[model samples]
Target chain A: MNNEHAEVMEMHMPTEKIVGQTDLYSIKSSTVRTPDAMPRPIRVKAREVNVFYGSKQALFDVSIDVPERAVTAFIGPSGCGKSTFLRCFNRMNDTIEGSKVTGRIELDGADIYDGSIDVVELRARIGMVFQKPNPFPKSIYENVAYGPRIHGLASAKGDLDRIVETSLQKAGLWNEVKDRLHEPGTGLSGGQQQRLCIARAIAVSPEVILMDEPCSALDPIATAKVEELIDELRENYTIVIVTHSMQQAARVSQRTAMFHLGYLVEEGPTDKMFTNPEEKRTQDYITGRFG
Target chain B: MNSLIVATLLLILIGFAYQVGWSRSRQVAPAGGRLHSRPNYHGARVAIWALVPALLILGLWAFFSDAASRAFVMAQLPSDVRAMGGSELAQALSRIEQIATGFGVVGEPAPYESAAGQALREFRNLAFALVVAAAAGTGALGLYLARRRIAPRLRARDEVERVVRYLLIACSVVAILTTIGIVASLLTEALRFFTFVSPIDFFFGTVWNPRFSTVGAGTGEYGLLPLLWGTVMIASIAMLVSLPIGLMTAVYLTQYARPNIRNAVKPVVEVLAGIPTIVYGFFALVTVGPFLAGIGDLVGLDIRATSALTAGIVMGIMIIPFISSLSDDIIRQVPRAMRDGSLGLGATQSETIRRVILPAALPGIVGAFLLAVSRAIGETMIVVLAAGNSPYLRLNPGEPVSTVTVTIVNQLTGDTDFASPQSLVAFALGLTLFLMTLILNVVALFIVRRYREQYE
Candidate 1:
């Protein structure tokens, strides 16, 4: 585990140095994709998506297809628009002032950004976990119960308790927190808090869960546990994660999309993208040589 | 040879010591070797050493000079005059001091008085000169010793820092000592008051009519309950008016308003706090008082022009900024992640605020409320002008009431003898007010600390 963590750290070292060196304007639209032999049904499709903060463009015409019941990881250097694009899925960017998103995002064949669609319901259907563990400063049970209660997913006390239990169980946190469910979720360890956040997102029964660097703030041991939980969650929920660690993407994701300077450089099955990439930039990034 | 001239001379000497030390340190520096501290630190160390001892000597001299002069004057008096009683001795000493300072006595001075005055003047001038010379000599010695110690290995910065730390401690000690001194004086005066009126009667008595009486003729009822009741009633009413409006205003400013609107409106709201309470008193007396009475007449109610409700509503308006501004800052302190987490859970903005943000910010908001309550309780001007001084312990808000602060003002004003219970009772009221505010502040601090620990 330590060896793997060290390798992940080594993979991230070069990326940190390249920040503020890459000019956004010089990057052209270069997307190389490998067609899957056995294609899964798509859960979410974003097309020609462009994001801007005030007048400064953050994501430039980036598009991707997220397949159902599988993990797709967006891997990039810092400030490469991966998290920005992930936030676009849950419409979390709307919370930011003077932020504008121009494009269409479809979930299950309906435009999520359409005027008729309620943002509350759309967010309920698509939940998000932040870079840091953001469990509400509430009891452990209440943290998981927050979503189910707010979305009216549970009708009775028994139902809410059952929901909280199952969600915690699914996040693999039930055994550790069952006796201390009344305690504040913030008092939990970093790994437990992150799992609790995952449990909170799951309690709402979201069809898709968007995680932005979920394990970035966790230790190596906790990172492995969360990675294992992510693999299990992929069997039921369509998962899209934005990670800085390329090793994490290779380990957990079935498909990997690499973003550079606000542009999607290439995307394919994780194995093919890591071992034999079509784009020279993807190869360089994978081998820790690209600036 | 006055102390001011000595102080000015010491200042100049200290400046010269700094320059001398700087040059000495530079001369003592080894070739191609760095000193332990900069030249400025050495200079500052020397300057501090020069100033502190001189200031101490001057302070000691100033403290003892008056007593020494009085002793000398008494010794020089004729034996017959020296046998006078304490009051006569004091009178004789003042007359001699007046003569010495060239302020002539009421009538022609006696031979002994003139002789004593001349002797006192010569003695004072000689003593003053001697103290000044001693202070200057010790200051020069300190400057010379400090300058000799300035070398390449000398830790001048450390020494200077130690002095600076002591200076800071001295300043804080001064502040704490002042508070302790005020409390001690109040306690003594209040105890004196209790001697006239029993503590039980003053504290638990129902009526509060402190009439002036001659010594040993106790005929006043100094009850605390009525004034305390009035203060509580007025404060409750003020809290009732301010809490909801202040909290809502804070919520609107932090959660709902746009950046432009918040920027434009926040200062305007805080401007309410800067308006003098005296002006608010005037508004309560001239505007709110008459307005409420006019409305009462319309509704066939018998509301007095100067009533608890009028003063309370005006005081509430005056403290609106304290609650709103403090609550605004605290609500904003709730991490943005908490809000995002709630909003991501499919909660509406208001639902998120009501369920999460408000609960998370509840402790701090409660602390703000307590602070505003204390402010309301301590408020004097508004209640003085608007709440009529009935001191009847009435239950109705429409009727005029007198709070502890108003009563204290009433008792302290006019030509009243300080030794009388009527005047000394003001000290007891002041002490009670202080303790009440102090307790509220402590509770507020505890809540705020707990809130901080939970979040941070």
Candidate 2:
């Protein structure tokens, strides 16, 4: 279902004509076993995705697949529509009043944008954390427990408590915040607040997590903790992260998708995508020829 | 007005003098390395040192002048006029001024008129001398203080910061004191009313008929239950009409409307608030009241044209802008990321608002609604004109009613003596209204605090 018309029409995608080869010295080719090969059965596949806000088309026909239980990173310049396409994955675009998405997005072989889908239930399965921490104006424990309570994950008070505790522990924030469980979530430092948000998203036990520049608002230390958390979360959940920092995408993601304007430039194993890209646009962007 | 002019004048003089002092000091020791504060800060410090004292002196003098000047003129008056008692003495001085100014006396000139005019002229001269001397002494003291530290090492910035801190504190203290004064006045008047009418009777009595006077003159029965009920009914109607519509308009502005439409429509709504309540009152009175009565006649239902419904509906219109404007700001303040976060989790627009946004902004929205409710209750002009001057308690929106503000206005109109129970009733009603609004304001403050603490 991936339409190639948009990829050719978008002028913002950087173009690099390949006149020389032999730069890809370390990319595992067909000659070698690509360490950590992509698993069988993709969990989410987005095809021919074109998005528009009124008359302004933001994303061209972008197509990509997210394999289960691995982190996929979308790397691009500002306003490249990488995040826009990522939002389409969970039907997050539906929240925008006038924003329209015309494409097929299937999650677990079910049409995500189908008329009969329950948006609330879909959201419960695909949670997200934002660039800046957005913990509810409640206690640290309550912040973690909010999603579980809303989704009815816990039936009793003890179950709710245990869920909250486990979520915090998974987010790597329980030890520091255990003493202040009843204290305000916002009273924590920036790094701690980001963890609180992760704990919040995981409380409902979502199968997939979308992060929109999750570490952009944080300091180096906080960014490292979030990156580490992303790596750990990949063991159980599929994660798609939109990042401006190329180094960060390289650090945490097993697969990398490069977008320019609205077009999906290139995507594959992280190492191969970075070292040698089939598309000229991907090469220029990765080699810093132009933004 | 004169004090403002004098403060401005002194401030200018001090500013110029400060510049001169700083420039002269620098000239005496040119290129004094690492001068304390920038040159402007140094100049401001000196200017403040001079102006602050002079302003204080002038303000204190202005406050006391009326009494002090009156004392001076009265003491200097001849013994004959002084002995004529309070009213006579006042009349004599006014007549003397008229004669002296060549307006001529109303009839033949009285014998004491010329002497009175001379005494007044002397009093004016004495006042002028005293004010000038006081101002000069203040300027001198300020100059002496400012001159002592015209050096680079002076902690001029720190000194200025201290002065600014005190100035801000003093301004807020004035606002606090004014509130205290209003509350105290309300409390004292309510206490006086309570002495005549028991609190229990005023609160619970079903019937309201006044039979008040002195015990022998004509003891009046004062019952507040009917008035309270009417006020609450009208307010409830107003809130019911305004709250939902206002909140929806807020949602449209924040969520649905385009930026251009929002910009255009927002000011139009704000203009509704700017149009005085009296104008809305008149619209309710001259237009809506008759319109309702006509509808009532056609429907075969007995409806008073000038009824609580008319006033309450118009009051609701008056408050729509208030609610919409505040709710718009609160909803907009709920953060774009929160919506994105919810949406990214696959929630639709309405679902995101209901589940995440509205809950997050609930305290702020409630705060806005409460503030509008208080505005509806305290409003006077709409009810005074639109609603009939009847205090009977009834639940029907179409029936005649009166609000606390309307009752106060009805009792305290012109030509009535202030000492009568009818007139004093206004103060008692005012006290009750004040307390109600005060409670509402405190609740709004507390709810708004939660909104502020959302991400503290």
Best by TM-score: 1
DockQ of 1: 0.63
TM-score of chain A of each: 0.87, 0.88
lDDT of 2 by residue, B85-144 (tens): 878787877787775455777787667677656666666566656665666567657766
Which residues of candidate 1, in runs, are more than 4 Å off?
A: A1-37, B1-4, B86-88, B103-115, B214-217
Per-residue lDDT tens digits for candidate 1, residues B1-456, read: 465797689889888989988888899989999999999999999998888888888899879989899888878988888898689888988999999988999988888899999998899889878888888888899999888888899999999999999999999999999999999999999999999889999889999887755444666898999999999999999999999999999999999998999999999999999999999999999999999999999999989999999999999998889999999999999999899988988899999999899999999999999999999999999999999988988889999999999999998887778988899999999999999999999999999999999876
Q: Least accurate stretch of 10 residues (summed lDDT) in model 1 chain B? A: B210-219
lDDT of 2 at B339: 74
- First chain of model 1: TM-score? 0.87
Error of 1 at B251 (Å): 1.5
Q: What is the TM-score of chain A in candidate 2?
A: 0.88
Instruction: List, residue by residue over A1-291, the lDDT tens digit for candidate 1.
Output: 235434543564544333321221112112122233577899999999999999999988888899998889999788889999999998999999889999999999898889999999999999999888988888999999988887888888999999999999999999999999999999999999999999999999999999999999999999989998998898799999999887788778889999876778788887687766776567667766644
